[model samples]
Target: MDILAKERKLLELEKQVEALGNNEAVNKLKSEIEKYKHNEMTKLTAWDRVLLARHQKRPTALDFINYMSPDFIELHGDRLYSDDKSIVGGIGSINGVPFTIVAQQKGKDLENNLERNFAMPHPEGYRKALRLMEQAEKFKRPIITIIDTPGAYPGIGAEERGQGHAIAQNLLKMSEFSVPIISVVIGEGGSGGALALGVANKVLMLENAIYSILSPEGYASILWKDASLAPKAAEVMKLTAYDLEEFEIIDGIIKEPLGGAHYDKRETFKRTKQAIITEYNKLRRLSGTELQYRRTSKIRKFGFFQRFNYDNLGGIKR
Candidate 1:
């Protein structure tokens, strides 16, 4: 029921736009949406955007997987703890090229939410993902990961089971894997939860998807002692896909629909599929060793462009 209000207004907008048929009224709505969205979102704090990333109505990893992948056969269980419903893994074909798809799925509706634990995966969930990753590597299938989670599960039980270690292991495993792996952030990508699956050859983020170390609220709470300053924090943090791309932190940006992914998932999927298809072909040509080096260089380049002052030396030093 949380996203119900947004859904209702969205339907109204849809009907209104359809009847207006690209007329002034439809254009007005578009303008209004852009302004309102920018105004509200720009002011959001890190944690506020985190909430938006986890919005129930926002399209999930499963939605994109179903739209883009062919013959999805989901694999389950961590072989350590009971299967964490948050992460969905399996063998599938991306753009008809055989690939192993792994995605973080946020549940909608009561039953599914309970099943998915609100898209927060436990230690076993990550372990299961690693298992699938190794299996995919064995078959030489390029891995595709769909990221969407507000970080890993923070529950006491999850920590007790070595959650941080599992996430760290995933990052290390992904970095050294010979097979090509591509990750796209379709929705909320917070902290290590996103990074665990994000160490890849190409990292793509949807226009609206955010990738940040901490939510605006969390950052504000810790640094400023007030969560109300989240919007300011969001502005300073550069969590937007555009911002990340500008900094060369992510490889590409997958554009969304006119309004947002929450407004029209079909349009979002269309563009996302194109991005994946493009990357898949491009990376497939490279040798496994070459791919790893490229990936390594890409990640290492982040924040590498820092001050190289050589004023005292009187020459531009390398």
Candidate 2:
């Protein structure tokens, strides 16, 4: 019931997703989670959801990459600007099969946070991501991305380099990419910073992670001119896992450890590896034509959805 604790909430959510024995009891819980019925998630606050995404104990992209794959070959620089530490990618082998992974890392400590820019990609960061993704295409290797950022750095320098265009380019590039691509939002997938690396044949998110256009504080600041009501805004935004999943924006959910990825790294990593491998196996078995169809078909089916436009003034245009 204490959903404020990311770890505990994640464990409960994991139990909901996994195969809990006693069919009758499981069915009861399942029914309760269903929105059509009395959903327990109705109690969540917007800021609470955002906090879960940025929880101190949440697993970082690096943590997952370090354990999930071995002997990673990291690449750097945008070839246009300085290298951005926020984004790291290169040739890596998962289960001994070579592939390229683009992982966006958030800071775990003050020093690390400074280096990673709090996982906020600058224009160069996005450019670097774009460069590596091109490499994946050249080698005919599948692309896997881990998204974890509060959002792109919206500073004068970043804007000068065309941050919007950089993100747009990535979206266009990934959509038409020739190789299999899967993106997983491990935590705090915010705005264009996250979307720059988010396009994929299939997208996944951990149970406690949140993916949204903006963080609750930013949303609150813009809408209410007050950053204190982020929790209220989070509920309004519906940035949680079940919310996005039900909307069909993401393809699947990667169940985390009992308390969350941070709670049990080994267990969480195992589950993550299984999900990645399962998707890889499914994609790898198909022929070029089949893969192409599968890829396009998966995208063409997405709902371009419309929502009530909520601007800062409490004015929602219908």
Candidate 3:
């Protein structure tokens, strides 16, 4: 059975045990359920982590922002276009240290998701994020970006508004920012939408989060002509936190609760807050020049590859 199916079965048993109240059998049943849960969690595959990352109850960017900075005040608009609800930016403080916070905000349900455009940003969203980051640099406050988007919006309106240009501008500006910046991938970090806010001194991802150029289903559809093979595609894509960390693409990984972040949001928030603060403390010691240099240096090192001679294999020579 799948993880959710097993969880449902366990829930049913717990309900039955509750009816029998104060008995040794109930205690024994509870212990078995706990054991089962632990074993299943330990055996999770990459696809399972993907599902967990996209879990409905998983805490969103705003949830983490509010937990880390109770006094967070949201700012709106790209100053040129209307406000894009998909991306949120503002000022907040963590442990008395002020920061400019930017994040992709996903809604809790269908209605809210529609309002947020399913967290798929438009051109204005990236522009708003850039505006906020520029302000952060001017004020000398560290910037924290929470990434959790499948990708940027690809609708006709977004394209007409220059979605690609907006994302590219953010990338160019972020690399030159003279303030400390840290980005965290809390869930699905797909394509340039995520990378637009991801050029940071330190990049981190939750244990279960996935980051890649595209979604596994999209990859499967393009490569194998079958979207149903997403599970297999996930394995080959290596989009998991451990995989990215192994490749040295991500700086660090924050631990999640047993099942997922949604299982224990308070613990998840605590760990995320601690991780961000710890990374920021380290980056805070460096000068603005050093910070920009390190960030750009890190970006330049991506996509390293070795060249081989095709003549040796009886193939066309370069």
Candidate 4:
């Protein structure tokens, strides 16, 4: 069988083992499964990493919370319309460091994904995120945002409810917060939806995650009239963590497990937690105003280009 088929078989076996509860037989089977994982995930290309980022077995924000933070108390509601499940935020402690954690939740299965709108949050979600950030600021607790959205929901309901305004508001307000803000792009960080929660003193990306204005498929459809050219688009877009790290678009990278995060959840959680702690500790040393200035400075330094010298065009004849 192909690697894809083998992966599916392994996933099914894992579910069966889970359903049967733990046993010596199950433990042995689990060990056998682990042996196959490294082979299944061969050397990955950018497009392969994209596929892995969207893999159903991959851990999401809630998974990271459960593994990395204890005593998490989830807060709900935008207080205007209703609570948006796509964006999960609350108070939590990471190794006893109090923080307000906001995360984009892309559900585990099709039914749950539909329920969370595949993690494309609405206006209320952004509003809800801002509300939580303000609370974090009020309490002088640090803020950490996990960004994993395809983009802000562009549905009529979301637009009518001021989705653009809501995201814009978050960008403006989060910058003024008097507490440390660290944003992690754990998966698909797309456009303003990702940015709404990403105005942070430090921005981190998982090794396999992609952060960009839009998906490669979307980029291809708009520019090349064919979504199948997405592989080519992915290369040119420079959305991978490695690319972003070189461009200084992100503060640092949380290295994934050998095959990917899905291959080993515990290791990924450890790496992510360490990256957060290290970066946050550095930001914590700075005063609130200094944090804001550094964040603003870091953002402004991105994507600048020098004017072309037309006067020196076509190579001088000297």
Please report, in order, the local distance difference test score of every candidate based on alpha carbons.
0.83, 0.80, 0.94, 0.89
Residue by residue across 121-204, what tens digits does model 4's lDDT show? 999999999999999998899999999998999999999999999999999998788789999998889999899999999999
Give lDDT tens digits, candidate 2, residues 1-318. Answer: 334553356457657656676677777776655542223333545455566667787878878888888788899999997999999988888998888999898888899999989988998988899899898888889999999988899999999999999999998788777788888898888988898888787788887789988778888899999998777778888898888889888878887654346667778778887898888887887665666676667667766667667686688766
The TM-score that candidate 2 achieves is 0.80
lDDT of 4: 0.89
TM-score of 4: 0.86
TM-score of 3: 0.95
Q: Per-residue CA lDDT of candidate 1, range 1-318, in tens? A: 223344466568667767777878678888886565555444534444445566667888888888888588999998877888899999888656888888888887889988898778899999999999999889898999999888898999999999999999998888888898899998888899889999999999987789999887898899899998877787788998878998988999987654457767888889998998899889989998999899888888878777788978898866
Could you tally the backbone clashes for each prediction? 10, 5, 0, 0
lDDT of 3: 0.94
Q: What local lDDT does model 1 show for residue 113?
A: 80
Winning candidate number (lDDT): 3
The alpha-carbon lDDT assigned to residue 183 of candidate 4 equals: 93
Candidate 2, lDDT over the whole model: 0.80
Point to the candidate with the largest TM-score: 3
Stretches off by above 4 angstroms in model 2 are 1-47, 287-318
The window of 10 residues in a row where model 3 has the poorest summed lDDT is: 1-10
Q: Tell me, what's the RMSD of every candidate?
A: 4.6, 8.4, 2.1, 4.9
Per-residue lDDT value at 77 in model 2: 94
